[model samples]
Each structure stands twice: as structure tokens, then as C-alpha cells.
Target: MAPVPVAEGIFTWPSDEPQLIGSRCTSCQIVTFPVQASCPRCASTKMEAHLLARRGRLWAWTTQEFPPPSPPYAGPTGDAFVPFGVGYVELGGEVRVETRLTVADPEALTEGMEMELVLVPFRADEDGDEVMTFAFRPAD
Candidate 1:
């Protein structure tokens, strides 16, 4: 299990939900994932942060066999193959999010599979308050 930020304001979690603070351009009516303070296309700075929908369609995915370095990620430390998945999630309106997948088994995942987002606890310190994160789950 691991947590990583795939884009600005877009964080991916092990079993957690994937959330991307997003912005919808009022002028062009285009929604962008990983919220932008200013529109990259039209240079409009009138952007608002919006919570994206939990459900997304599988765009792509992959696995990681090598352990990620410390500092940013604090997950299992081993050489064993850790099968992971990530891809673009189409949320309609031309809005797509890059995030990880939550499948029972990595091998069972496929393109165009429906996915649902879930907010989950990542780690807890000595104080016992769980530091939370987000990821995507297969939609039921």
C-alpha cells in the first residue's frame, strides 16, 4: 500500500480514494483536473476549486516491482514485486484524472472498467490520529 501525488492537488492512495482539486473554466467551459489557479488555455485567473466525482472509467494501469524511495512515500520495504495500477479516469466534460486503481488483484484490472473513489486513512503517528489519503475502487 502506498500514497503518491500524481498531479498538483491530485493524490493517489493505496486503498484510499483519488481526489483532484479541479477548476472549471467559465469562459471556455472546460474542466481541468489538478485545479489550476489560472486557466492554462485562455489565461483566465477566475478559477474555483471543486471536488471531483468519485467514479471514473479506467484509462490505463501498470505495476511496480521495485520499492519507491523514502521521504515522500513510507510504505513496505521489500524487493518483492508489488503490483500497482494507474491511469487516466474519464469524468465526462473532457475532465480526466490520473490516478491509481483499486482492484482485488492487479491482474484482474482492465481498460474501461468503472472505478469509484474512496477516502481512506494512510498512517497514524504516536498521537493516534490517522493521517488520511485517497484512492479509487472498482465501482459496484
Candidate 2:
């Protein structure tokens, strides 16, 4: 089975180095993740696909101690579930992306710490294919 992205167009796939896909407002220049059709600042429909910075600073974070509700959360559950880190990482002063963090220990994570984008295994599908998702880890 082949590894697959959690969803389409969230990040660049089939590449050695992947970057998150965002939308920049052609009018106001505001950037948003998951690509938006309209600008949140100016409400303009003119938006373009923007490749976000691969590195950033951790702005804020917390741990998801429990499994998120199933409809939107497709990862492991019950005994298979594990706590993971979640945070917003500010990329190139363009935007702050809310993402999963590779480090789960809050003590190990600090605000303004340097971070880099990475792809991590999210879960296995019914077909046993690996589902990959984007995350951030402390930059060396």
C-alpha cells in the first residue's frame, strides 16, 4: 500500500521537501491556510495559492490529551490513542498555521522556539495504507 495525504491540497506531496499550501489575498495580501476562496480581511474573492515558509517560530501550543471526536479525527483511539502536541506556528510573518507538533511534552516546547515543517504518519487506513499529515518539530 502507498502512503497518502490526509487530504488534498493541504501540502505538497510526492516531494523530498514539502511545504504547506496557503492562499494569499491578491487584494489585501492576507494569507490563510487550507487555502481560502475569499480574503478574511478584505472579503475579496481574488486569492492565489501561496507556498508557506518551511520554517517558523512556535507561537503557542498545548497537548491533546484525549482523542478528538471521530467525524473529523480519523487517528487512533482508546488504547491505541496517544497524547500529541498541537500549536500555531508563525511562518515568515505571513501567517500562523495551527498544526500538530512532533513534541508532546509541554516542558520541551517553548514559545518563540524555532520550528521546521515535517510530514508524519497520522494513521493507517482500512486498506492499511499509511496516512501522512504535516507537523512541526524543533529545528536543529
Point to the candidate with the largest lDDT. 2
The residue-by-residue lDDT of candidate 1 on 1-140, one tens digit each, is 33333333654334244555678887776688777778878888888766677677878677555666776766445654344556677775367787656553666788888888766544554565555545677888
Candidate 2 lDDT tens digits, 36-138 = 8999899999999999999999999999999999978889999999999999999999899999999999789999999999999999999999999999999
Q: Candidate 1, residue 67: CA error in Å? A: 2.1
List ranges where model 2 is wrong by over 4 Å. Answer: none
Provide the overall lDDT of each model, using Cα atoms, as 2-decimal numbers: 0.65, 0.96
Q: Top TM-score: which candidate number?
A: 2
Q: Give the TM-score of candidate 1.
A: 0.71
Model 1: per-residue Cα lDDT at residue 140? 85
Q: List residue ranges in candidate 1 displaced over 4 A.
A: 1-20, 79-83
